[model samples]
Each structure stands twice: as C-alpha cells, then as structure tokens.
Target: MKPGALALVTGANRGIGLETARQLAQRGAVVLLGSRDAVRGEAAARSLDPDGARILPVALDVTDTRSVAALAKRLERDHGRLDVLVNNAGVFVGATAADTTAEVTRDILAVNVVGAVAVMHAMLPLLRRSSAPRVVNVSSTTASFGLTSSGADLAGDASVRLAYTASKAALNMLTVQYDRAFRQDPDLAHIKINSASPGWTATGMNGFRAPRTVREGARAVVTLATLPDEGPSGGFFDEHGQLVW
Candidate 1:
C-alpha cells in the first residue's frame, strides 16, 4: 500500500485481470495495467482509478520479447521495484482431446505457458528489489491433474477444451519450478510464489459461460499477490482454500 508498492498485471484490459487491477488500486497499490494494446490498457487503468494516480498503463504483449523488455525498462525507470506480479495473460482455444491437434496445443502453450514465463523473466530483477515481492499465476482447475485424472472436467455442460487444460498444467509446473529456484535465499524466500484456480469464472475468455464472475476470480489472485511476510509458496489454491497439486 505504500506509494512505491507497484503491482503489474498482464492482460489487464478486461476480465479477471481488470478486476484484479481495480481491487489492487482500491487497496492503495499502484496498479500497472499491462495490455497488448496501449490504448486499451490506458482505458482500463482510467476506468479503475480515474482521479487517483495509482493506475498506469504499460504496453505489453506477453508472447513478444521486445514488448516484454521494453516494459521492464519502463518500469525500472519509473518504479525501480515491483511488489507484485500477476501473470494473467492467457488464451484458450477449444481443442478437445479427440479433435485436438498438436498445432493447437502448441499455440495454446505458447501464450498460456511460455508467455507467462517470459513476463516473469523480464520483471524478476524489479521484483527482487522489493522487500515483500509476490508472484501469482492465474491458473484454472482444469490444470489440476488430479481433477482431470478423476474425469472431473468442470467444463462438462460447457465446451470441452484440451489445449487450454494442458497449457494450465504446464503453467502449474512452471510456478513450482520458480518457487524451488528461489528457495535458498532467505530474503527471497519471503517472496510468495503460488498459482491459483479461480474456479469457472466468467471472463472475456471462455465466451463468459463460466459460473463465477471476474470479481470472484480476482480475490484469490489479489490475496496471493499481497501475502504477509510468512506465507506459503509453491502451492496452488482457490477462493475456498488450498487445492491439491
């Protein structure tokens, strides 16, 4: 909540990301709206906090390296440090197992998995500068192997998607890897690294057939982003509580 405690959220132009930005700004944190389109990002920021100086827009396309680096440099010059990072930029092409192709899976992973890591790699330096840094990767229940293994495809009545689920599964592993990578440093150890399943949230993605709203989805992400000094890392959670890997 400090003046310099900035939080960057990718794909923040709408859906859960936008709601998360709004909530963060409401809590006195400077929210950086990282959207692929500059104009849209600016619009989202303004909508979140019109008169407040806490909302700013950063043009970022998670899948593009040039945009990622540019955003990192921009943030380094402006804030020098970042308190929270929400890698919320992702896509879901309805590719079911029966009809899903390798190309479709690759494309989905490119954005949902690789894109998230690229963003993290770009902003890690800034995050390290913070006293209480946090990383929250917005994931889904479909990513849960246990859930999927049990054939609990929550998308039952909705459009069944394979590429999307696989991408999130890869993302969960990425989250765990990041957590393990920084486990040695005591200072960095306090930096909570976790993934969360926002349930079936109604967002711009998934055609909005999801039962939950973006506001509800934003809760778990925001909570993980602003964890206390003593908080769990290398875990997946939801609005209800901890979820099995």
Candidate 2:
C-alpha cells in the first residue's frame, strides 16, 4: 500500500494479527488494531505506538453485525477510506472428526468464515474509495484438500480438526468468489483479494508450540495486504509465493 495508507487488522490484540499490524505501521501505513475487547485493543495499540500516532485501536467483533457496522461507520467518519483490510480474526478449537459436533462446526464457521465475510461487506464502501484496494483473508494450509490428499505434512491436521480446516477452506472459497464479484464492478475491478495462509506459527492458538514466530507468520499476510495493482487476485499464498492449493 502507499505510504500513510489506512489499514485495518482484526484480532490485533495478540499473536500474528498484532505482528501484522506492527509490520504495516512500520511500513508507514496508518493501522487500526481491532480487538473484541476494547481494553486489550487500547493496550496493544499503546504498546505498538505509544504516541498514538499511526496505530489506532478499535473495537470490532466480526461476528456481531452491530459491532461491525459501528466500526465501519467510525472508520468512514475518521479515515474516509480504507486501503488495506486484513481479516485476521479467527478461532481454533481442536476436535477429532468423530468428536466434532454440528454446534462446534457452526461455531468455528461463524467466526472464521461468516465473520470475515461480514467485515468485508462492512468495509466495502471504504475499500471502494481507495484507488488500489487489497483484502487478505488469513487462512491456513490445513484447509487444502490437495495437501491432505497428497499426503503433505498438513494432511493429519486437515483430517483431525474437521471444523477448523473446513472453515478455512470455505474462507478460501470466499476469497475467490469475492474477487470474481469485484471484477464485475468497474469501481472494484482493480481490487485485489486473496487468501494468505500464515503457515504454522507459535501463537496462543497452539500454546506457542508451533515452530514459526509471529513475525514469520505475519509476513505473507502483510504481503497480500500491500499487494501492487498488478498482483494476482483470488490466489492462495505463503511467504515464498503463490500456493497451488
């Protein structure tokens, strides 16, 4: 994104989301650090930007339509436009296939998929105002059928956490679908949207047991969030490059 560009990252109170917000602000963008808890969000923003210059904290609960709309209205009032939107808010709960219930799947999907969609819709107006808008939906490689079927390392993860994996797969599909929809509208045709799998990262989600650091995990996400006009849309990517799955 251009310098001083406005960016919003959900779930920015901790983990990869916070790292992404920091990286974006470091690159000279004005970032909104979103958190469900206002107090945590404020603390995070203060920690990142003590002067309260670029990094601003906001209350945003993607699952709550009222909360999403309120945040969107505030953004429109304060920033006028948004150049980058990182849908990094997500939830993970481990459960075996047989152990997963419909309620569990629904709950996971509610945040990982539905909530992200809600945020996108709320931010569409602000995004449409940008000359080059970009949206990155933070996803996971475990969502890949190709990886699982080909006996890749994430194969086991894909089979075990049925709800989490399935929700991410659905989120990836949303990226493609949203990109296609944008193409039909001249105002949004230039908008870039993609799924960024941060890969395995040491975050609170896994009790920090994962090998990757938050900085490493946020790399791919920031890449997509700041994609150039010529960058590919509707693609799944990691830090290296475009992912086949």
Candidate 3:
C-alpha cells in the first residue's frame, strides 16, 4: 500500500491475523494490532516490534458496541484516518450441523458476522478520510455456497460446524453489500472492499489442524488489504484466485 498508511487488524494476538499485521508493517504501513484482551494485544505488538516503531496494540472486543466505538474514537483522535481494516477476528466451535445448538450458532455469529460488521460500521468514517481505503473481511472456503454444494473437501464435509460455516457465509454477503454501497456512493467510491479465504490455515481457530501455515494463509488477506486503487471490489478471493460466492 501507500507508505506509512494506517492499518488495523483484528484478532492480531496470533495466527493469520498476527502474520498479516507483520506483513503490513514490513511493507511500511503503520499497523494497529487489535485483540480482545489488552495484555495479550500489547504482548503481541511487543513481540513484533520491541521498540514499538510501527505496530501498536489496541484493546478491541468486536462483539461489544462500546468497545468498537472506543477503538474508532481512539483511532480518530490519534491518527485522524484509517487506510486499511482487516476484519480477521473470528471464533469456531466444532460441531456438526445436526448437533449445533442455537446458542452455539449465535455465539459464532456474534464474532464472525455481527462483530465484523460492527467494526466496519464504526470505522467507516475514519476510512472515508483516506484517499484510498480498503476493508478486507477474512472469510473461508467453507463460506462459499458453490464449493460447499460441489463437495469441496472440508467445505462440503458433513461434519463441518454449522455455526462457523453459516457465519462466514453471512460475512461474505456483508462484504459484497458494503462494497456495492461504497461503489455507488460517489464520495466513497475510492474505498475497496473484499472478502478473503485464507485456505485452511493452521490457526488456533481450527485447533492447528490445517495444513497451510499462518504466513501462507495471510497472503490473500494482505494482498486484498494492500490492493491498488484499480483492484476489484465486491469479490471473494483466495490464494489461487477469485472464488464463486
């Protein structure tokens, strides 16, 4: 992206989020590492940059409206604008569709779907201030209806967790709708919005079962986050290429 661009990444205490933040910082962006816990967030930021040169940790519990608002306010007061937002914070509770309870589904949606949207909503004003802004929603292949229906590995696995799968599907739609809205608004047309699937990375969310490393999984996210002004929006993509919704 632009030199010294401001970027915020959620769930940055570990896994793909952490890697994404690291990559962004390496590319010269001032990165904000957001975590639900302040202590963990600060530690993660320190681990990435002991001198606190480029990365800053911020306490952000996406499920709480007040916490999201507080983060937005802090960003505005400190930095004035946000150039990139990586909506990577998510939760997974493994249970088959048949065994998944309403409560479990609700909990998953609270983080994976509602929490993502809430953060985006609160950060839009700050994003608009940037000459080129981007919002990358970290999604999954399981979220793709085409892949799931076509029996694509874990995405079509009969034992996949319904709550997690459904929440990601919702997140994909959220990305599409937000992108469309921004594109139609002349004043905000410069904003780029896209959903990215990290391709089954070995993150804590999956109990470290996936084959891909966090660095590999974070590639698509960083690509979308740092997309040029001419890049596509309202699209779903993976490491290989674009995906069907």
Encode model 2's per-residue lDDT on 69-158: one tens digit a residue: 999999899889999999999999888888899899889999999999999999999999999899999999888878867877762355
Q: What is the C-alpha RMSD of each candidate to the true structure, in Å?
A: 1.7, 1.2, 1.2
Cα error, residue 106 of model 3, in Å, equals 0.4
Q: Can you list the residue pairs that collide in candidate 3?
A: none
Candidate 1 has an lDDT of: 0.85
lDDT against the true structure, each candidate: 0.85, 0.92, 0.92
lDDT of 3 by residue, 12-112 (tens): 99999999999999999999999999999999999999999999999999999999999999999998999999999999888876879999898999999
Cα deviation of 59, candidate 1, in Å? 0.2
The Cα error of candidate 2 at residue 7, in Å, is 0.2
Error in Å for residue 87 of model 3: 0.3
Off by over 4 Å in 2: 155-159
Candidate 1 vs candidate 2: the TM-score winner is 2
Q: Locate the minimum summed-lDDT window of 10 residues in model 3.
A: 152-161
